[model samples]
Target: MATQGRSTLDRRRFLGLSAAGAAALGLGMAGSAAAQTPSGASRMPPSIAALGPVLGKAVPIADDEYRARLAKAQRLLAEQGMDAVFIGAGTTLRYFVDLNWWGSERTAGVLLTRSGDPIYITPEFERSRAMEQVRFGSEIRTWQENQSPFDLIARTLRDRGIATGTLGIEEQLPFFMADGIGKAAPQLHLVSATPVTAGCRAVKSEAEIALLQIANDATLACYHAVWQALQPGMTQQDVQALVAQAYGRMGVRGFVDINVGKYTAQPHGSIEPQKIVEGTVVILDDGCQVHGYTSDITRTFVLGKASDKMKRVFSIVQQAQIAAREAARTGGMMGDIDAAARKVIADGGYGPGYKYFTHRLGHGIGMDMHEWYYAVGDSRQPILSNMTLSDEPGIYIPGEFGVRLEECMVTTPAGGRWFTPQSPSIELPFG
Candidate 1:
């Protein structure tokens, strides 16, 4: 049986730990806006306790739209010469079925063939719950605890006239489960279905883009609230709790990494106690979900005032982010954006590329925070219309500090436009 908190599990899957990750995150907070506990290094974030939720619109993808996604995936499967793709209880299944299921020890998901409708697989006990959420497909198949679902899967494939053919398994599907399926059905060859799932998901549809934009906007608002509420004595946990509360107040759920002072240099950051004092640099990277679509953005700035060097590095990061955004053009190569962004960081004297400017320029962001066809150095993938990506570029000077400015942008008929405005300057990051 799927737990009632299935939605929270989905969010946790998207957001790895940071407070936002494990400890700092408080773990159980959903829209509840739980208070901080055990006061390790700090008290809770400043009050937004008086505020109410700011949620606006929320409607899941329509039935016909999910069908369209299936159509696209089918086309990709044919191109890849695969007979069917087995998606097991994750985002890919959610994307196609509009159902949120927790992957468990039992085999549960859908076996989507190259043509016709999809077959949803689940334990006999979960059939009712899974059935209620099914949007695109009607065929439901179930197996008992003693039976191997893998055998059922083989039977289904063979029933669909796929006795001996290729099966594209979801890349994230547990290898043990895939192995079980392969062992049960030796005649079927299994391959990575990334070309099917990521191929369909990498590019956002109009509805997906709208939800993504809303999610990003809400995340920005929460970050803005955190910045305004920040005080010098505040601990990193304090700010983290504040962001969580603010997200609840705004009727959105998100995860944020509040890196203070030198802690910002480590990128994803440390769990050590951090207090925001005068001239302390902070990096806030976070995102929230709108109807299951995701939004991610990062902004870096100084607390009271920035030193000249801090400002310089911040500017360079801001410039690198902008260069990456502007470099995105339809029909162009994906690698170009990363190169353009890296050039700005290198030219700004933070170069010796990949040394100080660690990590890729950006990544595809939509459903998954870091999706496929990333904007790493020299990727040969061509830019496509309505494809969404993050233009995040940073300079991390190990012992000093790090500055990363990120904005989620979508490829359009023209070029690319950010879901939210890029931080203009260190002095006025929100501007």
Candidate 2:
């Protein structure tokens, strides 16, 4: 599907987001979720052997796109007055060059110079493997096990006539590596390269938005199916297994963080065993990925008919999420979105700040879940078009229950639009 249109969005908006088509909701989460023992499931599941591939539709990013990212990083380096930027072997390197190398005690990195092509730094023993994955770099500077990679990096910099200017290092670079580089070449000044790395990654391209849309749609589909399949006494792990099976059926991979009963108050997860009980709150918080892009969504509702108090609190949280979404504007201050959400909660008799909403309003999501441009009370970053972030606002009452409603959204000229529509209500949570 074409990723952009003006009148189509206007028509959808007028028709009501709830009435909009089902392409927006997909993908979800698991793994680091709450501890749960496998239990008697609520439904039958297909054998793992029978499940089809989850990544069948995903396409690796194009080579030309990776090259464009390098060019953008180089431009940012020049603007920031840096001679070069060292991209460590994690997300930033993957963001710029599509290489999925792991970071370790051994220093493997990508050196992107402002004046020339990118360089790959590899352990001598892994040079051939590095070439197999290397997309943008032609020069590979290899360091043997007995040799000091730090010294090699310094000498390489000096060789490139970048002996004294500031070198921008990605923020995730290990301290030992940075310290070694500093000691090896005390003449070079090291600074955080967040501006370059985040600058390039903060905004999503059209293709990225398409992939994210698919991811969110697939996961939300899993959520809808699993919620209907839920039975009254299923354990949290049972619910998780069902969600996984739904993902397998939907042809996407995902996870579900299900907190039943009183454990719903814990945000990240609960270690205590829990099960569905009458009128107890259930929170399903999670997301999924498509072609390395991700979607983060959280939906909370009661397993049975909600209490009047539960319904009231859910309405407040839902309004808070809506406030956050409506407040996002291209070029507007990022803090405005959080402030708007907080205002609704505070006005609805739930706040005094973090007393109710204990966490920041949201986080940027892409190759990583929590990335650049956080939605907090004091952030001053401007919202740019195609920048996607979670719009989750909640009220956590320690001894009682918590209510959180999150949806992934992208900034457009017309304001923020969700990858999935906000939940319909406390009674119809998945809608």
Best by TM-score: 1
Instruction: State the lDDT at 248 in candidate 1.
Output: 67
Q: Find the 10 residues in a row with the least total lDDT in model 1.
A: 1-10
Per-residue lDDT of model 2, residues 138-167, tens digit only: 899999999999999999999999889999
| Residue 293 CA displacement from its true place in model 1, Å | 1.3
Across 1-431, the per-residue lDDT of candidate 1 in tens digits comes to 00111232133233233333334355335235454422432333444554456445766788888889999999999999999999998777888877789887888988888899999888999989988888776898999998999999999888999999899999878889999999999988889998889889888888998888888888888777677777788776666667766676677667776677777888777767777887878888868778877777888877678899999998888888878888887888889999998998889998877988888877787777767667878799999988998888888988888888889899865667999998887767787
What lDDT score is found at residue 142 in candidate 2?
A: 97
Per-candidate clashes come to 5, 15
Quick one: best lDDT, which candidate?
A: 1
Give the TM-score (vs. native) of candidate 2.
Answer: 0.88
